[model samples]
Target chain A: MSQNLPLPPIALPGQPLAQSPPYAAGPGTYTTQNPTRTVITASVAGIPRVHADKSVSVTRPSPSHPLLLLPEVASTVLARVTRLNPRQATVEIFAIQGGGDGIHGGGDGGCVCEHTFQGVIRAQDVRATEKDRIKMLESFRVGDVVRAVVISLGDQSNYYLSTASNSLGVVVAHSDAGDPLHPINWRQMACARTGIVEERKVAKPI
Target chain B: MTDRRRINGPLEGTIPPVFLTSSTHKSIIKRSPTTLRKIFLKTGLTPPATGSAFLELPTPSTHSTPTLKLTSSVYGPRPLPSSTTFSSNARLTAELKFSPFSTPGRRRGYIRDGVERDLSAQLSIALGKSVAVGKYPKSAIDVFVSVLDCEGGLGDAGDEAGGGVDVGLMSVLATAISCASAAIADAGIECFDLVAGGVAGLVLEQGGVVEEDRVEKSLEVGQDSDDARRGMRKNGKVTLVLDPSPIDGYIILAAAAVGYMAARDELTLVWTKGSMGWDGDSTDEVERIVDGAITASTGVRLVINEAVKERLLLGLKEMGLIRGKAVSGDGDAAMS
Candidate 1:
């Protein structure tokens, strides 16, 4: 694959990088098939790299490529709870875990976006064990930062997110006295300054 | 008979200030039909935009140089409005506007008029096909082109005497298409190919002798004697010129602007205006005019490719991927 063509260090969009039979297309690259053969081309202007596994990809020079950081289905996102209703909790998604990894890995592991996207956590999707007994107020409150996974790209306005797993719930919250809350267990958080225990869905510490 | 409510100007009418026109204005310089005017293109001018570019056609030595300046900015692949229905592809929109002072004599209105709307639609058509829209589902990409300055032909007296085609606007559209394409490429939008625009026109120079051989060639096309006589009576030598400027002082018979993708060998948009049925077969004339425009676009494509590469080289340098000096040579070495 390396001997196929002398690939330019930087490639413009649509510039062919490698042949598809020996190399598969990866991120920042797409394949186009003609009558004779399939060719992998750079989809963005960036440095084209050929991986050890014979996969060809392009890495954008700028780490903060804005549009490429969009959240997709099954991606873990960190969002702040903005509003609460009888059946759902509205959130503004601020960060997305890079590569959709549940664990926080080192070096470029996540993307913190400038503009937030809207999402919703319905009462039914708050937890997995008790579907009918979930209460929106007890599970989440306004201004609580929660970690969740996108389940569906719902309607025109909001993405449907779920916090059903033990590792996906409120990571940060405040007490009624405006003190920071620390998670004590799966369903409670205590403010050290006020010693006021609050009921909430708590994510297990990584 | 008038009640005083607000302060007003003096009761006596006053004459407006006037200034002398510059005396250094000169006629357009003659260039070959295949040559294109110099173009200066740069990307990433507007910091707030996802991508931006500026284009200028500068004729420094000519006193009466037509000011052709344009800037384009691309925003989004962001979320769509709530009112729009769900879509599996990104929605692309383009808007072209002329600033109030873009033209020389007459001022353009802030409101979008028929000309701006028409150019915007044509720009949208020119850009829509090249983008890989399917990859960005339920998002919107908007391209805005602002014509900062242009050749003064909007309300020129010469336009009425020449053919009805607005050669100035055609050239503006062509430049705008190229500028917007550069901005889109800078935005890192996935596309099959970059689209470059070009314009060509059939110009009739007055008092020039028509070649007898060319006249006989037109006659051989099976046109009636009456048509041949009419064609002969229309005095002047007709020549197809690439990148025609209205400042050239020639009567433009017909003009075509094409948005061409050189790599794919495809034409995304073709706009032609003016009367072309006088001398030769109309269909063949149109085809020739379009062919000329494609040739001009291919020339523009080379410049666009160089500009894109220059920016990429700068990016790679900043990222420390390639070391100082000998940038191009080092880029290849580092990648390999």
Candidate 2:
């Protein structure tokens, strides 16, 4: 019965690894303490990894595995504009880009999200210049995909988003004639099939 | 109230009652009264659910041991109802139901009963402590538990004296807590820890005799109304048993059960039945009982971790990242 067997690196939620001063908590890890010691435990099911700085973290075995990702302040997100009101444009956030790599993990299931986070683009956060005269309907359509940065974890129901930078704004949309449109300017897009120009706060393409 | 399409029970014959009594049926395997029945737990069985698990506590003697079997499913961290006002924390809900044929007595109704409702509330409270609710604000997580088989009836412990322990309810709650935590983990819900539950009771000895030796005497005393009962009330000694079956001869002076987070050394839920006296001197007795229950939960926590790790290994094997020939039952080795 004595065979050399290596331990699997997997860590389940709530599993404790080591006491904290020597091991700082990283992503997928959270710290808790008793009267005597501070302990680090995995918050998600994944493989436990120790970094060079003695900080410990857990990472999913596969990148494609489904996991719920919450939108944090200053994180870039991909969202579809759902509707518009006088003060803000309502959007549903579907994909979150990581802070370091900018790698996107869209909603858990491919093309279908079990849970979609709500976000909002306020008139003031839409562009850097126009804080007073920005109209929600003119800047974003019902089905436009917008690249935005989360400004704040807004009210209970939504995250506040901003697209004020030159690189952020409408990434995809359709013209009134029902054709794909490309950005023609910072404020407009043109349909290739009909050559019809439409008003939008367009983003710079990479 | 009158739906002709619904099937009804027979109206003619008088049915027998099924109580949680000591079994007369002889078991093939002989075990000490203190040993817990072996537990078998597996996760990810229900494909449609976000996560699911099945649990079985089987004894060697098929007919004599009261079998406990259950399954739990977790559905979401999805959007909340639109009609509700905004909530900053994730809402957690649990529902527990017994199948119609799970028990030996009358079939259960489709609607939830008071017992089921109470257990559901307790389950939700126990699980809510471990989940990272603040992370998924404005969303809700739903857990549904179904008892496929059970050994006792609803009124089994209700009519008993204060010194009596509700073994059936304790077992059901303990199993539900363990199973639901696995399903939540399988669903990939972020949690600070997985909670494991266990039950323990204080065995009160009489005179110079040990509690186990007094089973026959206590049974005979139960037949006599007043004198015998009063005579047996004096306390001599008390010992705690981690997992006590109904047949255990101990007169349970106090019983306690808890949902324990082993890694963090915290308790999410603590349920107590019977009194450990109201006097200040009895504080140590109560603490001792609670500590015993926590130790039992650690044993259960080990088993829960093994089941979860087994699933993780299978997933790794599927990706060709790990070898497939590793033995699955190497329990203690994997844990250490």
Candidate 3:
């Protein structure tokens, strides 16, 4: 059966096959109806405490605790709350805005780089990122522009994202190579030459 | 006196019984779930012009009670259009599809939705990096996907704003890489290294969750480039999960591999451990999602590596890369 198989360049744990170990549990510890986490939790041996949290969850939940979502992802993808069931609410992000909006709209207005970020806003703290929220320090609002990196191609309908970066953002009024445009600080920032006011991500170089 | 016996219940619409548990608090408890045998390498298993593979995923644990099952397929390594095609390079096209019965409710039809379209594009980019396209002359390959069944937290059903569960997609892409590698072997196509794909989704808790990250300068940094994360996320969105069935997003993370060199220490270690991580030491589930995605991606990368090895060995056997030179059977010929 393993004849025509693709052998590993470097030996991996489950060398013969990519299959998992089948099972892992320490009697009563694992039998709990819904433990806080999986055996993978203990597997984080040498990783620093802070870095360890970056791993993704397996199929099963830890019973009560839900997974954490990055605020950066939420802010980037313009997510929206579609439904709120007993346990949680469903947020979906549509078009990443000009200035990068998230499903959570829980951060300051900014862009990651060129891509407009659109965050999904289903539940408040469920998966949004706090670390990113602190950096941006802003709340998401309806109509506010947003954008996001398509984190992953999820199951059927929902996609995953992270606005954790500064570049991926919404483009409110995108300017071109030489498009005569002005910021919307005032209703009209009359330019000395053109005397025209437009909406754009005006660079206010500090 | 008539054979027609009408019931009081309206028959216009019928409700179908569904099975596929959601995630539970206890992850260590190994329960007997459904078998996803239909989604694997053995199935049909062939790419059109170049490489192909199938992605098999255990049921998702996001929604109801964590008994989700999924399967994905990838195909590609063909030729490119004259304009887009490189002189010495091959081209790629990716396709992602979901079965109507794959989800909880009746799914939308055969139409390739906008989200799926975008995802396909991303898959192309994600795998493009590892493929030795330049080795091939004017050829294009296509990647195809089909989701058999999705349950519970398996994926997001929220299409309100054109976002879907990304976890499944990434998982499938990883699987596809495996299949593609196999096909590439069958076809004996050259490549830098097989690129692996994985899902990294945040199952956001309600507030109060701290998490963290990597040293690799993000190919796509925030608030930087004009294309922003687009170049970095050139492939497209990877799914993010808030609570189980609650919130979600799409952020795509591709493997930065050029035949082994792409995988770093962190990624290598995680794969060496044998298991993909779901939780480390943080209350925030998102952290695990991030790390999990990366680690799982490593696993996917390895899978691709194996496929590449097989493909290369076979291709070389066919092309005679490893065979001894045409040694003259006779002594005179040998001398000449």
* Docking quality (DockQ) for each candidate: 0.50, 0.39, 0.01
What lDDT does candidate 2 reach at residue A116? 75
> Where in model 2 is the C-alpha error above 4 Å?
A1-8, A34-37, A52-54, A62-65, A100-113, B1-30, B59-66, B154-163, B203-239, B247-253, B275-285, B321-336
In terms of docking quality, model 2 is acceptable
Residue-by-residue lDDT tens digits, candidate 1, B77-152: 7888878887878899999999998877667889999889989999999999888888777788999999998876
Say what the RMSD of model 1 is: 5.2
Task: Give the per-residue lDDT of model 1 (tens digit) for A84-117.
Answer: 9979999999988854521111115676764688
**Local error of candidate 3 at residue A156 (angstroms):** 39
lDDT of 3 by residue, A77-135 (tens): 44443443433234445433333221111113322221111223222332234533232
lDDT of candidate 2 over B1-336, digit per residue (tens): 656798966768877987685542222343443556578899889977878889886542555556778899998887777656678788999999889877655677788888899999999999999998887777888999999877544335343422355566777888899999988877778789998888887765544335435543664657763333344444345677776544444567678889998877789899987666544456887888788888778888888898877776565555443323453223223334
Best candidate (score: lDDT): 1
Candidate 3: segments with Cα more than 4 A from true spot: A1-206, B1-44, B47-51, B59-88, B152-156, B159-186, B201-292, B303-336
**Clashes in model 2: which pairs?**
A14-B193
Q: Give the Å shift of residue B178 in candidate 2.
A: 1.3
| Candidate 1 runs further than 4 Å off | A1-5, A63-67, A100-107, B1-15, B22-26, B59-64, B155-158, B205-237, B277-280, B321-336
**TM-score for the A chain of candidate 2:** 0.81
Per-model TM-score, in order, reads 0.86, 0.79, 0.35
Fraction of true A-B contacts recovered by candidate 2: 0.52
Minimum summed lDDT over a 10-residue window in model 2 chain B is located at B327-336
Residue by residue across A1-206, what tens digits does model 2's lDDT show? 21232213678887777679877877677888769999888887766666566767665543224555666677788899998898989999887764422111232222235567888999999999967999987899999999899888777678899999998999999988789999899999999999989999898998
Judged by whole-model lDDT over C-alpha atoms, candidate 2 comes out at 0.74
